[model samples]
Target: MTQHHQPAPAPAPAFAHAQDGTALAYQHRGQGPPLVLLAGQANDHHWWDGVREDFHTVRSTITLDLRGTGDSDKPEGPYSIDQFADDVVAVLNALGIERADVYGTSMGGRVAQSLAIRHPERIRRLVLGCTSPGGPHAVERDASVRRSLAQPDPQAVRRALADLMYSPHWQAAHPGPYRTLGDPRMPAHARRAHLIASNGHDAWSELPRVAAPTLILHGDQDRLTPPDNLPLLASRIPGARTHLFPGARHAYFEECREEAGTLVREFLLEEG
Candidate 1:
């Protein structure tokens, strides 16, 4: 017997406009409580391709490239975390979504924090993964990873990102994501602007002001943000909790999609 699988439901109202008139490209998938997915800094929407099916399976997810990456407008330099937050708001408004559960990874987590602090009413629950709360006190990655980000060639840049993002075993096990990971739309300057924006992101004082329930997820083997940052986030934000994934790196969600999805779904539904 030949059995055909049912096609997944599509998330409608794909495109949206940013406050600065930048045409932000976005896609919505699944159905339930609206969940906005913010990617890492300098990472396009495609970065979430591996684990998206898990999150989208139970709830509506809004995934978009934050201005400088992917198909989003790469206007000049001087981008800030606040600006990225506004871009998220623009997309939610365009979709007529009043509030949403937010899940952000790496630099995208910075954007989520800014949104929660700046626009508290817009978020239902916050999920931050493999990111840092920047400032003079913030712990940084190794110098080599920083240098890799500044590389002139995109291939080298991606290679550097992989080194900083994934554990060696994970890489050897799954090579397709990196092999096909290529985005020519992001210029070097735009990536620099993203790094610049991420600089001095001191949410230390502002985290206490975030009014939404929060969950912080991190990988034990993460080299970029370091697993130590997880405790800082959980302690700073009021009533925030954390989850640690052993043997996982920065891309913990993707590495452990099935488990992560169940945790997230339960949190959003039961906690929030």
Candidate 2:
């Protein structure tokens, strides 16, 4: 007997205009309490591909492409973290969502910090994964890891990223292709702008103002954003909690998606 599997529901895509009049692309998927998933530096909504399905089981996710990547407008540089947060607000407004839970990783986590700080009323719960507060207070990765990422060859850089993002055991168990650092579709200028914006993020002084309940997550083995940021975030964000994934790397949420997703869902659903 040939059994037929139902096709997965495609994301409903739409566009919203930021305060700067730049167009941002967003997709809505699943059905439940709203949750916004923000991408990392130079990445698009697809950055959540690895773990979105897990979250979708318990959430109605809204994912958007920040100004400089994917289906969004690629405007000129000097983008700020506040600007990225505002862009997210624009998308939420377009969807008529006043407040929602937020999950962000890497640069997205930085943006989430700005969002909760700058627009306090708009966030219900916050989850930050593998990200930092930046500025002088932040912990920087090792020089060797930095050098490996800065390699001139694109393939070499990707290989280095793969190692930083996944564990050897995970890689050995999964013999498929690995993910890249950023969106290949992003223009060079936009990527540079994203890097500058990401590097400029500094919310340490402002973290105490975040009104929403927050959860910080990271991989013990993460080298990209480094695992140190987890405690730093939890300590600064008032009443924030934390979780560390053992043997996982930068992509800990994906490497241990099931466990990560369960923690997130429970946190978001918990009473204030």
Q: Pick the candidate with the highest lDDT.
A: 2
21-89: candidate 2 lDDT, tens digit per residue: 999999998799899999888888878776776776668999999998988999988898899999999
lDDT of 1 by residue, 8-83 (tens): 5544436688877898888887778789988887778777767676665568778887788777788997999999
Report each candidate's C-alpha RMSD, comma-separated, in the order given. Answer: 3.4, 3.1
Residue 32, model 1: lDDT of: 83
Q: TM-scores, in order shown? A: 0.90, 0.95
Best-fitting candidate, scored by TM-score: 2
Clashes of 1: 0
TM-score of 2: 0.95
Cα error of candidate 1 at position 98, Å: 0.4
lDDT of 1 at 4: 23
lDDT, residue 108, candidate 1: 89
* Residue 156 miss distance in model 2 (angstroms): 0.5
